[model samples]
Target: MRSQKLYTSFGILIIFIAIFFLKQNFLGEKYQDEHHYLPTAVFFSKEPIPSLDLLKSYGELNTPVPFILGGWVVSVFGENIQCLRLLTFAVSFALLMIFVWGSPDHSKRFFLCLAGLMIFPNYYLCSVYYYTDIFAMIGVLAGVVAYIRKAHGWGMLFFIGAVASRQYMLAFPAAIVAYECLELLKKGFSVKQFFTGLLTDKTWLPYALAVLSIVPWVLLWKGPAPAAVMTMQYYDSDKLIQYNFGYVIYSSACLAVYYIIPEVLITRNLRYFIDFPKNHPRLFIGYIILIGALITLFPAKQAYNPYFTWPYLGYVDQLFMTIGITGFFKQIVFGLLMLITMMRFFSPYFNLTSCVVLINILLLGKAQLSWDKYSLPMIMVLWFLAMFDNHWLFTASNRKQDKLFYH
Candidate 1:
């Protein structure tokens, strides 16, 4: 049975890779962040790192590792656009392998999680685009998996790589530290014990290394200039808070519609939401109503649509964008759900893996832009978290065994 399941997963992976290559060929052009990174890659191909002038001009807009990798590929492969994209595809395939390898063996959840990841629109789009997000995510996912498996040295190494891929990935190591601190507290360790653990525990090495990894980048970065300062001035804290909150809710809603709903429908896994109407029917019905209203009232056209545009998919883009509203009632409902999910962070059943997942979500929510690519890591984390048997938030008792199997 295990052999058959593994074979099936391998077959699915092969099919997914084929489809990804087909999409890349069909799309046939670069857009958005690809433009930014490609130029950097070309420069790096010649220079191998940004000069002081380049750093001062670009002002830490792009990080090093992805561009470095792209440079190597371009050097060997003769500067072909497809070659750079092929590198991204290779990195993405490695990411998929890591997820599969880290997943619980002989479990149907492995297949389901892989399916969720492949079918996610952003993951599909990012897989084809020549960008650094996937490369950074490769390190993030590997680091999280290593931490979960208690491989501290490997986790720290991947975390460093992740930081090198993108500066924003510093959130990941910070999340790890937070998780460890919370764990110590849960174990009834005193302040002295906590400090002692930090000094003594091998697991704590990752946290320290995570801090050290930033030093080189800090020394190299030339810092943002006057224009960047002006840009920051445009979005004040009030506006940023509003934008961030709306993005968090809207992105979560999109995740439900694009990924979660489809998964439930295809698998007939109503058990995934067994607690929804059962535990709070009014809240459940209200959420359903809000979703329906959002769909109905969504604008057909928008001035600022950041979504990937495929042929004949403009309406779908508008539909998803409709969730990007910041009305009082919408905020109230979304805030409620956010609160519930946040509460799960304090649950004793919530393990290190769950803590990491929740922390990533929280940090990503604060990001200014609401791109689908930004949410891909969260989707993968959700898939991995689903593999665990414990119900972090919904468990009736600590000792209760209420596993939600995919099959």
Candidate 2:
């Protein structure tokens, strides 16, 4: 049975790889962000090492890691754009391997979940682009997996790398801290006991290190902040709340249409919830009304102009676009069902991951426009937590142990 499952997973992975390869080759350049990085890479390749002044001149808004990686690739492979895409594909493939390997004892369910994640549209879309988001995502996943396996040192290193790749990843360490607090509470520890435990726990040293990693980036930051960077410029509390509420609704619909639905279909769990509405007519009606109101008030529309060129958008945008009210209804239903499944099957991790994703989305709402690129890290983290089948830190049985850790 295990062999069969492994074979099935490998088969799926092969197909996924082939699809991405074809898309990159036939579809042409689908991401515009590459224009920003390609020039930085070329300049860096010529320099002995990237100086802070050089980065500042380029008006590099984000951290220097992606440019450094891109520079190294250009240095070795020359200036072929396809090489950069291949590099992204290789990193993405590594992320898949990490996901498969991180499963609890390499369980079939975990492998199946990873197979579903690989085919997610946003994830695959990013993979074909020469963007830094993939690197940040891989770093975050590596850190999470390392911490889960009780490798504190490696976890700290990976987490630090993640932040360097994308500053927004600071949310991840905060999420880990929150999860740890919940773990303490689940063990019947008082608030005092929890604080004491947190202060003294050697296992938590890595998180502290991860948090401190942000200091260097902040101190050394040289360029003007990009408009895409999260800031408090639009900090009207009431307006912020209103905008974020709408952003969440719209983002949830996108996730449902592009990611959650595919996951449900692949896991064959759609049938499990098919009779829910029939079982509770009033509750079902209430849900429908609530969802309908949200859709009407905060409809999902393109957050930004298409990241691809006009000719490319003509074909690709239509393929990914969700239509009007009818489409919104389908998305809300599938999204709600996916959330229900996640809570039922993976409550503790689900809640923790949701907190991280929600906080990140709210932060993104401060920007002028919402780009799918900004949400990729959060989405990746969500899928990771959703697919994780091990006992969570907050499980009652796990809490009974004096040392609460995932393994």
Candidate 3:
């Protein structure tokens, strides 16, 4: 009862903070997808200009679904920036509710953590913009929550909705496939059960519904080709030929270390003193693959990719802030504790691993001249470390008590 009250208080606090930020004007709200989505709302009721010159010069319909929906919003509520931003604000708030309600273990700390995440570039930027990313993430989070609750049928519906919102959502589907494959392997690939579930399970019904929703777009909306979308139109044959093998090898090594460390720390339930089933290897692997996809999807030349479509980022932002803070006594204590544990357990293999990762980020930032989005992933890594560090501290304390009592 006390915990519930605390969570409620925290939720209200976070919501209030979010409201303040959402309303404040920030440097004129210049970002990608702003132009793309807002105009759909602008010209919805009005007949679209038939001139190919206008479409070519300014607005080429990027995706039909968002435009159609934005058009609907415009028709109902009158076309304006605030109306479009309000739609995003509503979705952002919905995302908060989904995150709070969907959490299996809802605590005050979680809400407080979420409040801190509200300031992340991705979360803040999306909250005030006109884009489908928030909508897509909301669907994905809904699907994840439903899946966790064993409501696979509902989960699939959200999954399909997510994919329909943005086809690049295949990264998440790939993660799901990896997870399911791991489970199947553990069960010795029960063919009869697998086939039966695939054919008759309600979980797959959303996928069926998704097909209905998607078929129209797939058949009628002719925009960019598959190759254009996937390759991001930046990969050049000459660049590939000129690529230095040594540089490639070093960068790859750095990225692997960056992801593997977090996966090892969090996925094993090592921080929580809980044991995950062997059947759930996909949990860690899925996370790793998702991170990899985020990095790779945004190629060197392109500024944005389909990253924010995944909802985990908002919470991940909280994790970053958790690590990025300094000066507080609590922060100092936790930092020392983490430093000691890392030196004790992992230093032998990765004495300079942190430095290497930092160097890679700095180099990448210099190359791109955009270090802001990189903070999203960087902060998540720090949060992963903090979680494990705090877990080990508590575990060691408990073990010490146990030894004293037993002895």
Candidate 1 wrong stretches, greater than 4 Å: 1-9, 24-27, 49-60, 215-219, 222-243, 251-317, 320-348, 389-396, 399-407
TM-score of each: 0.74, 0.71, 0.52
How do the residues 1-407 of candidate 1 rate in per-residue lDDT, one tens digit apiece? 45755686588578766876677553466676676677767767776565665543442244678877888887777667778887887788889878777776655566677778887767766777787888888998898788778888888999899877876676677767876776677778888997888778657667658757877655754231223522443422344343243454545544555555665666665553564456445655665675455434541122132333332222233443376643455444444444334332333345554555556555655554455556677677667766655432233452322233343
Q: Name the top lDDT candidate.
A: 1
Which 10 consecutive residues of model 1 have the lowest summed lDDT?
299-308
Q: Residues 149-249, candidate 3, lDDT per residue (tens digit)?
A: 66877777786776566543433433344344333444564788766655654443454455355444445433321223324433323333342322222
Cα deviation at 25, candidate 1, in Å, is 4.3
Residue pairs with backbone overlap in model 1: none
Model 2 CA deviation exceeding 4 Å by range: 1-31, 222-243, 258-322, 326-351, 372-375, 393-407
Q: Name the candidate, 1 or 3, with the larger lDDT value.
A: 1
lDDT of 2: 0.60
Cα RMSD to the true fold for all candidates: 6.0, 6.7, 11.7
The candidate with the higher lDDT, 1 or 2, is 1
- Indicate the residue-level lDDT of 237 in model 2: 33
